[model samples]
Target: MTDGVEPGTVRPGGRTARVREAVLRAAEDALTEQGFTGLDLADVARRAQVGKTTVYRRWGTVTGLVADLLQDMAEQSAPRTETGSLLGDLTANARLVQRTLTDPRQGALFKALIAAATGDVKTAAALHRFYDIRVREWAPCVRQAVERGEVPEGTDPHDVIRAVSAPLYYHLLISGGRLDEPTADRAAEAAAMAARAGVFVRVGGKQA
Candidate 1:
């Protein structure tokens, strides 16, 4: 967001990186406690103990700040687990999602972000990018499954990975159902079944 110091140009653990960490943590706390509409750069600056001018110059706008927050979330997401089987790996993935969406702070932050994305195209793009990064993080699990002959070789890894978490999100954002670990396992089991049966493979007879 700053001029001259391009995005991703800051050295790791540098001053700019430290400022981003503080600001983003403050932003996360605000979003968790008061949702997206309550997000303000001044408040974030006060909370982060950084200068208002610095926050202003770094992020420019609330929308830009939210976008940066999403980018940080994408980078901070955990890598995929390596279980011995497809179902094991997917279940682990599903449970990670379940734990996140059920946790009070994490759930509230995501809800605020998702709600903001509904009306803002830029926010929606940022949200999509966040999901893409998260999905890519776990895509390797599907590739391993293919090598182990658990799923079809031509399976679309991203499709299978998304399917595992789709229902859990439905419960969180749409269905208002439970977010229990069992529900997570069921979602994972169903996705793994579909994937093994080639239901998640490309429709065009192509591999992804």
Candidate 2:
């Protein structure tokens, strides 16, 4: 079943693209409103105004549909911000994560997906891939920082990038703390400070 356009890409086509958009949007709505337990293929088709046959034939199962949704999200994620400084770049990333996790629709959708992934291996893999894509998107900025001599040599770019958002996600998923803009800025500050101190340098690479 292939109702989705494809993972890791946005293919160029009209009707197929429209169908993909509608289905993904409907899936987002359903997941936000009712969580994964309420994700039914027929209901999703109805919500999308596409045929039940189309949804069933394309997705085959809820797990597959959810996986496709994560892939679509990764593809549609915002482009990296270039600020010419590690702190600035990390601040941008943290702010993006903060905004996304605090928005009502998006926040709920993510909660549902995370919850679904906790019990489903396929969903978990898809979620991991989604983060991997996002991490890759921002890792370049860390590499640039290294070139600028901001961080130590052999710093794990991905680790530093992930650190910028780690606290925000911790608040979202663990601490139940507020995810405000200040919190985001602080997350960036902490990550940047640690990074500048060589806290994220590869174990065998370099140290402060």
Candidate 3:
């Protein structure tokens, strides 16, 4: 079925956005309370106080719902702030990443999502899309820095952005290291150092 806006809900510049926000929030809450395997559209509809038909009509399946939810989150998440310097931008970005990684609810939700993605191709694709959006959102800071001569001429902004969060994600998903503010700062500094040394610079038009 072709799912569009909910019936009786306005679109573009009005309550439609708010209704979508509420639905997404309910979906996140459902995901937090119950992992991917336990996620239920009925529960989400009940929590959101929206129509079940609307939920199902809008998202054909659980994977589609989760994918839409992740996309909405990426859109709502804060964008990179320009502080006129690479250090400032990287620090701010690192702090944001750390805060999200350390948040109990979000962290647990992510762990569950990772587990689900491990077994489900659809979920894995959705997860990849989420990271892609996040990476694209923050990559511009590194590009701006390059233009300002703060980094090498050939720095890969996307790689630089990904590098900033790689260590933090590794700690959370692998090493079990603490993701504290200090660690966040260290990651930013490390990424900065690497960029300065041309490590982030692309070679042979290929990203490493």
Candidate 4:
């Protein structure tokens, strides 16, 4: 692994990993600077300073490239930070979500991916996987809180984690509003309040 990355991850070693990062960075840059239609894998290969064959071999199509990009994002995402309090943990989670969704480069990249997903099943799957990984990562925090009795028993950790970012993303992507730190804090507070009120309690079989 490259310095701090855990083993068996895509880090700064191995030819494939190097090539993948180069291509992903190139793709991210291109997608941010240019629109989705303007994203040329050939250009990405050229910018990455790798052969077109390598790029093609790695990601066969634009959809495939986008999938790999989302996968890389999940892999490179920081692990959840535990602050021993649900509020603190949620604030951290909200801040991370706000920062990622508002970052110029990453935000525009996701916009491109979102547009791509409208026409590409593979891209949609990749986006789902990205959320799944994030949800799983943050769910443990809720579970820990439940175990500590900070929240009631049978609270759905996954739902709690999703609640922290769902409104943030909606405002970011749908409402076309600013995703600022205050908004993050608001989201965190709202989720914390809802959790305290048992809105996230595990229901019968379906909603949990």
Candidate 5:
């Protein structure tokens, strides 16, 4: 989904754009400090120094605002790294996720969003879309690996990309373990090895 307001409601570098930027940053601050359950449109408007009516007109509900926030984040996410080899590329991807989840603010923000998604359908769908975009961005690296004959034919690029970050999320949200460089490296290495072993290969339109 598109970020912020609907089409033609905001123009680039216009007042509406500025308002969107302020509101989204405020939303981030709220999510970081208070979690999803604490998010309030009036509070966001106060934080953003914008009119409550404006926020309401643009985003409608707390869930709608959050959906837009996720879209904005996806759009602002960094481009995938190209490291010439699948292991190197996957390592870069893993390290990126590690750093984000290890950061004080980002980690809390993601944890809040994830917790929100567990019970909220809109939040869950937004979160899924956010990851889908990110996965697509990195999937090309795996496809390139296939082209280079580094992985078996029919290797699923999306699966390989997801594998690199799965353990990192598990550490962040489940195990509460340290997300150090070694952990990221191990995740990347395992995914690379598994890909080479045909563990991610597709058979009959399904993962084998």
Candidate 6:
């Protein structure tokens, strides 16, 4: 085990990689079908056709396994899109989030993850890390928009990227509102407009 690293977090290769893939997939299946409360090392081992001892040794606990699962998800998430325009790029991003949140399996999986995060500090941290990775992935697009003079010089790129998907997530987790294409477009439009208006501009090292 690497020093200071959590169990099941070290990158592996060959057969180890295969095992990790199987285990993570099984974890996702458990989360989607039964939520975090139902996730079990032995059950996941059985689902992956691996030895329970191996699962227990590698993941240690369900929380550790879920943390690794979220890390894996962050690494596997789709790369950002570039449409040569801020609004277009934001629209693409919003639509991508909308699609993921609306897909039956993915939607349920996210709901489970979010529910798990609510009362679990480690799970909540893992969830935050996951979104932080995703936001960093798409932050460059907002920077590009700044280069094109589409937004203010001090506008926060990460904030703009998060804005595009915030409403979609709200719809998924909160109001249970519509998540159609039009809704996604509206989200992108609103974010783009806000960015243009400098609503996300940093003032004195903080958002104005």
Best by lDDT: 6
Enumerate residue pairs that collide in model 4: none
Worst 10 residues of 2 by lDDT: 1-10
* lDDT digits (tens) for residues 1-208 of candidate 2: 2345443234427677788789889999999999999999899999999998877766778887888889889989999999999999999999999999999999999999999999999889889999999999999999999999998888899898888988898999999988999999999999999988988888765543
lDDT of each: 0.88, 0.88, 0.82, 0.84, 0.92, 0.93
Instruction: Give the clashing residue pairs of candidate 6, or none.
Output: none
Highest TM-score: give the candidate number: 6
Cα distance off (Å), candidate 6, residue 94? 0.3
Q: Ten-residue segment with the worst summed lDDT in candidate 5?
A: 4-13
Off by over 4 Å in 4: 1-13
Can you rank all candidates by TM-score, best first? 6, 5, 2, 1, 4, 3
List TM-scores for all candidates, in order: 0.91, 0.92, 0.88, 0.89, 0.94, 0.98
The residue pairs that clash in candidate 5, if any, are none
RMSD of 4: 5.1
Candidate 1 overall Cα lDDT vs. reference?
Answer: 0.88
Q: Model 1: residues >4 Å from true position, as ranges?
A: 1-13, 203-208
Note the clash tally of each candidate.
Answer: 0, 0, 0, 0, 0, 0
| CA displacement after TM-score superposition, residue 83 of candidate 3 (Å) | 1.8
Candidate 1 RMSD to the correct structure: 2.5
Candidate 6 local lDDT, 114-150, one digit each (tens) = 9999999999999999999999999999999999999
lDDT by residue (86-106, candidate 5, tens digit) is 999999999999999999988
lDDT per residue, candidate 1, 42-117, as tens digits? Answer: 9999999999998887777888788888888888887889988999999999999999999998999999999999
Report how far residue 149 has shifted in candidate 4, in Å. Answer: 0.8
